[model samples]
Target chain A: MSQHSIAIIGVGKIAVDQHLPVIAKNPAFRLAALVSQRGIEQAGVPTFRTPAELYAAMPDLDAVAICTPPSVRHQVALEALNAGMNVLLEKPPAPTVSELADLVRQAAARRCVLFATWHSQYNAGVEEAKKRLAGRKIASLAITWKEDVRRWHPGQEWIWQPGGFGVFDPGINALSILTEIAPEPFFVTAATLTYPANRDTPIAARLTFASDAGLPGAALTAEFDWRQTGDQTWTIEIVVEDGTRLTLIDGGSKLAINGNLTVAEPMAEYEGIYARFAGLLDRGESAVDAAPFHLVADAMVVGKRETTDAFEW
Target chain B: MSQHSIAIIGVGKIAVDQHLPVIAKNPAFRLAALVSQRGIEQAGVPTFRTPAELYAAMPDLDAVAICTPPSVRHQVALEALNAGMNVLLEKPPAPTVSELADLVRQAAARRCVLFATWHSQYNAGVEEAKKRLAGRKIASLAITWKEDVRRWHPGQEWIWQPGGFGVFDPGINALSILTEIAPEPFFVTAATLTYPANRDTPIAARLTFASDAGLPGAALTAEFDWRQTGDQTWTIEIVVEDGTRLTLIDGGSKLAINGNLTVAEPMAEYEGIYARFAGLLDRGESAVDAAPFHLVADAMVVGKRETTDAFEW
Candidate 1:
């Protein structure tokens, strides 16, 4: 029941905007240190330039939250786990499934809780929707997640680089919600991924999925694009066999059933993530879900490539 | 045991060269029918242009072996499984991890034997090598699998298309052996994939792997390419902690220990594949190994993409 001493690694935008405030509010965790290369300093907290330095200085740290980009998260996480610290990973968890799988094993070997956080899965309406659709036979499902890269990611060069995941960086949030709320698991049957003429990653993608049992009239589709200039949309709609419709909008912060608003609340994805991580740490269990990552990798594996007009910031 | 009436779907080069002869020699399976678009007919066997036609005409078919290109294999395998027939999928399975996972689920629900055959895992010396390395400490491992796609594939255009897996089609065979023989599971850490200027898939790949527990001084690497014109080489070399070396050559048909030949035998990959499938069917169990496919998918997920000169058949 004692407060878990946690350090924040990679004090980037996400760490400041989401993690810091949440950790400040959570009673179960105390911010012990900050690790960042940018030399950002937090008042009343020890700051180190790297995870190695942080571990050396604060060997008693109970856990560390990694908010770095997917490309570099693995090394930092591995180091923390190796040092016997419980670890929490941000979305799109390592660049590849293999790296993430390795981390899971490492955490188990070290007896440290490794939580791969899918922030979107913690959206307020997600659990509510999952509860409502628990036994329903889904007839069809559709996900539309379109956002303007310029408006959201402004000037972030890593988004276009390999392992950056391009649109999938945001698109995976949708998949995380879908995988969490779906009545049953589904797999991608076909996909078409559109890449900017000059980039290594796709700017837009369309994927179709199917249930393993081939449910009658069951169809699922996910369309992700970074070209939306106005009225950015993030929505998932599922129709059950009895014609009951369920929709989650605003990135799963709101829920509506058959055109009637049921649950609309403020977003607290990161807070829920930390609370879950704390619970897992208390229970000595690792919560590393590979479904969302598997779907993203499957999209890349089967997606047909098409070149689009060059994208400019 | 009664002979299982099995149908061959998509009688391509692999089916003719490997499946036909293996089935002919296996006493547990009877080649009941053939399904193909090429109009190649086998004496005294009924032929259908499609799997649906074959299923309609012979509803009593016990099993089916799908040898179609991966892009189209999922649909055929799903159809066969839906009709309550046990299924045997060719190597690399059904294009993506999701598809293969779906098939495994479907077969389990239907109580049908679903065998995802990794033909190379059945190579003559693979088991012997696995036995030798079972309790050894691996210091390092290397896999070199280079072959001429021009000579092996000739004009197989499908190999260059999306989902074809390019060099990975053959590269996965190496992985099949690696996954089968390694003392512990390994995951990819980094990869570089080379794509032809005009192709959708990679023509070569280099990947590095590491164990979860950080095996003492252990390093693993795989190099796969389709440009080896002469002197086609498919070999795996492993170094143990005590300086003992193990090598598998000729696509795992031969094994050497400390530079001395330990096992040398003719390649009968497909024959072994059929024998394994028969055993699974007799035991009413589904044998589906997704490790090799998972590694390939991980490579694509984290791999840096580089464009090479345009490839011409």
Candidate 2:
């Protein structure tokens, strides 16, 4: 088997910190080129200022990973798919569900692999959690994801703009993991979104969910806030019908059961994503999961809005 | 063929104005019962305060038309499906996409008929427009839907509350027609939502769309407002690649092409809905088109927000 030639688009923080390093070590893919507006380039790789240039120069490129902002990802991926190239999109796929839906259609129509990767769902703990809760009925589940936005996304103005998702940027990672691990599908029942006085998006949100086959007294809820100053927390706790408890901590990188540590390991999320993408490309299949994105859009439509203190850099 | 015993849930404005009359005249259904929170009742029909009571009392009922508020339709229809009854939902189906998705799943799993009726799509003019646009390329499209909320939705506090779509309540009608008539799949590209200072939902919106196969210079847009005081307007104008302009007005009840009126008739939308429902029930299949609902949710997620003047009853 030969390695698939792939180019990385958008050489921003996530691409440099995670995607580039992971592709460098992965034997399934060879880094062919870079398409960056900032003219960012890598050693021994041709760089283009636009995707059209990349497609023209490397028409035989097997695939392209789009790491652009959520707002522009749809157009970028659509152009790549039109050029008969497999495409991979970063988390929160596109700003709108319709854009993502269009990409799914285009990918299938063009017979190209389209992988919408949620980096958090690639952890071993998340996979184990999904396995453990396969046939079990959930009595209750709670997700608490609170972090300092300035600490993680400093000087990122796009996060506050329209289509940026604001606090939902990190909150969707929790939803991605929840969708991956939940035994039954859940829908948002109620929500309250808190927007900064000067921002176009919410800075915090509280959501309640209901499952199809949930038992009596079942409670499903999530709280996401970007105001945490210290001790960042990203955790999900689930209680099954048998009263056994399972907890996923550190954004699904560690797992514990009944207050006992069961699995704790350093996460190689991007590596797992590339591996899955490789498998999908091999089978000529597209994996475009809209559950996590749907949940966020559901919260936005069904949730009540409140004004909070204005956020600042 | 035997007449199916059906019940009307949520005896509200729509139920009284449309569902009862249509069901009374339709030969395929028998009005079995009514579920109303306000204890509203009709001549020669059983009335129950809750769905639980209705289900317990009428276990043999074959189907139910859920005319409840969009916020509670999911729960009501789910229970009806659980009781082995087919369900038909009003326009917009549910408040969130997730809820509607759940209903579709439940209906399929239970082998019950689930018909999500977009009343505007039931018009003869809309059907004709769809037929004319089939296999044709779209050049441009515009939707203008403006109405006085005070006149149409007078004293309806739910229209201003959370989970209430506000202006989108009427705007979705235009979208329903658009989804029915458009030859190619289109997605929301940009939007601006205007919300009253004292309300939870938007009072006006402007949307821009992009199509997969749209011609160059194609401009697709919509303007929805609830502040119109005089004559109401519900219109859609479309231009194909061949430069023929097609127009639909009066909420999809009338159509014109190139200044020539082609189709115009009194709208019997509810009657059309029941006719379709009977066909779906007979075939044991479900028709849940989420395109219109998805566009609204997509706009909510991707659109910028603006604060307008306070709205009052």
Put down candidate 1 lDDT per residue, B115-214, tens digits, no spaces: 9889889876899988878877788899999999999989989888877888999999999998899887777877899999999889999999876423
- Per-residue CA lDDT of model 2 for B261-311, tens digit only, reads 999999999999998888888888799889999999989887889999999
Clashing pairs in 1: none
Query: What DockQ results do all the predictions give, each relative to the true complex?
Result: 0.52, 0.73
Give the distance in Å from residue A83's predicted Cα in candidate 1 to where it truly belongs. Answer: 5.9
- TM-score of every candidate: 0.82, 0.92
- Residue A216 lDDT in candidate 1: 76
* CAPRI class of candidate 1: medium
> Could you tell me how far off, in angstroms, the CA of residue B212 lies in candidate 1 after the best superposition?
6.8
